[model samples]
Target: MKKREVLLLAFAEHPEQREKCWISLSECNFSCKGCAALSKKERSRLISSKDLAYLVFKSSRYFWGKIIKIAVITGDEITLNPESLLSLISNLKDYSVKYFELSTNSFMIDEDLLKELIKLKLPILVKMDLKAYDEKIYKEYSGKSEVRVDESLNLFEGIDRRAKLIIKNWKIRYLTINPILTSK
Candidate 1:
């Protein structure tokens, strides 16, 4: 399926993390002042989910069976286009990816989306950055007063029996708490 939202596709080498395939989606929901992605002067083009999946599978072969340790789905916030993420991931069912690490702000995911992710039946690593535990700090950084950190955590817990693999085996990993620092 062709999607007009997905922007760029690239590969990187992380010694500690091994080879990785990075997909950058455009349009973020956050208004963080110091966001590096938003500050960049680059623009990416739209591509189909089939193309993205093909590239991911080919990227693994490029490593000569080294195993693409991680297939990272990141952008301003991938959850903004959950359909695209799910489409791309569903197409990746034939590959031998060790893990699919979704780096998100954890502000957009809810019960329905989590349930769809569980349907994928692939090992998932949610690298969520809890911007702040304090409401004042969160509002200052993310520019949103909703402060959904706790609510998002509860949503993850709401995943049904199908997602036992994620919760019971400890596949879900929360990232460090690093709020977007600004001079505001």
Candidate 2:
């Protein structure tokens, strides 16, 4: 199979820990109002998943004098490229990364993607950002309807139930963040 590639932004050590790092990705499915990533003038370059894994590993070693223990993959929307994301995770595991935290908008997740993630056999924490529950609020904030997010949530729930039966220890966890919105 051909290896997938993703748009990489940067790799940096976690604020408090040398053994932890953050892998930032560029581009997003949604153009949320006031998003900092959207405001940036610079564009991220596309990189193969294997190359990205190597760069992240090297960065951790260079900065921390050790391998990365935890890698948090965050982006405006990391789930935009499911294949590349899975490849990145698999590559990171090859580097012996112990844990992963993936932050996403939860608008792109589907059954196949979730299954691929579970097959990686790595402990992954999924941070699902729900812009807003109400359709109007969601549209106002993200300039997109909440229908996709709803579908993602439903799909995840169904897959997660089946996954629990297959895996002895299901390591994936979901965190929902609903930002408090103020009317203009």
Candidate 3:
């Protein structure tokens, strides 16, 4: 059977007052309770890397002279589809994209993935979510252990030539805090 693939597009505000066209892939490892996006049960079609890159290249033309600031690739968990995701990003290097942003939860990032990303040498920004500071809260919300979060963050920070590596905190719309935890 073929792997499931999806690309959701939208426009959003990027850092430094730039506007970016956002593309999101679906299916995630974690199903955080408050997430607004639909569940992973939704089906998706398969798209090849060349076709994906072509879509982004064509999308850039809509802005004309205004330089399409960046192409933001996000998802329920893009890191889960490392090969496809990287392939698409790598192929976009020749397009008008000035930068590429990959938004992920950091759970799927291992040392190997980090090494591969560094090797790509694409102007990429990683928007990662820390979720929660406490292990219990993190597990409660994201249904996963927090071990990989710190491990991934530390690995990303340890990159020797890290001028290109950016560790970012993702935004959460609503967070319910436990009074006991909040009081501490």
Candidate 4:
């Protein structure tokens, strides 16, 4: 029954069957309209750094051994847990998993963290979404009126600088922009 056992293992490991090991990394008070990850009326969980780290570490070992890709999405803001996440990245690098995927709202990520990521240069994929260009639009989206559009610009600039160094088996791409369309 070796063949049957192998088939059963493969079936168990299917993408749909594999656990979605999410590490809730932010405590958000604002609930934006278009944020798919958030609840329509209320906020989501605020996970601890240690808990997130453990989830990430388990996800790394589980997927890498099977050559499966770990799709890393955030609860609210990734920049909220930069140090813990940097450590997570180090773990992935140690495992030589070589594939990562992240999607973020680009609210918390800053220039220095961007620089640190550049240094790691892991085969990581990042997708950053900008709520809107103007401070008012962003404020409405994130509850932060003082949102620095210039800082976002600087992050993009850093990405531009580090794009070349990231070419070692990295599937690098930038989904550049923010638009506030009012259909009235």
lDDT of each: 0.66, 0.69, 0.67, 0.47
Best by lDDT: 2
Per residue, candidate 4 scores C-alpha lDDT tens digits across 32-74 of 7666543332333333334434444554456544432443545
Q: Which candidate wins on TM-score?
A: 2
Prediction 4 TM-score vs. true:
0.55
Over 1-184, each residue of candidate 2 has an lDDT whose tens digit, in order, gives 3333233434344344435656667667787888886214343445667987887777667665777888888867788778888888888889989998888988888888988888887888887788886999999999888998888778666443322221233223222212222111
Q: In model 2, which regions exceed 4 Å deviation?
A: 1-18, 158-184
**Cα lDDT tens digits for candidate 1, 20-108:** 67776666778876788732433545566777677667655665455465678887788877788888777765566667888798888
Model 3 scores worst on lDDT over the 10 consecutive residues at 175-184
The TM-score values for the models, in the order shown, are 0.73, 0.75, 0.74, 0.55
Which digits, one per residue and each the tens of the lDDT, describe model 3 over residues 10-113? 65443455656676666789878888653244434456667766765665555443445677788788888678777777777766567888889999988888
Could you tell me which residue pairs clash in candidate 4? Answer: none
Better of 2 and 3 by lDDT: 2
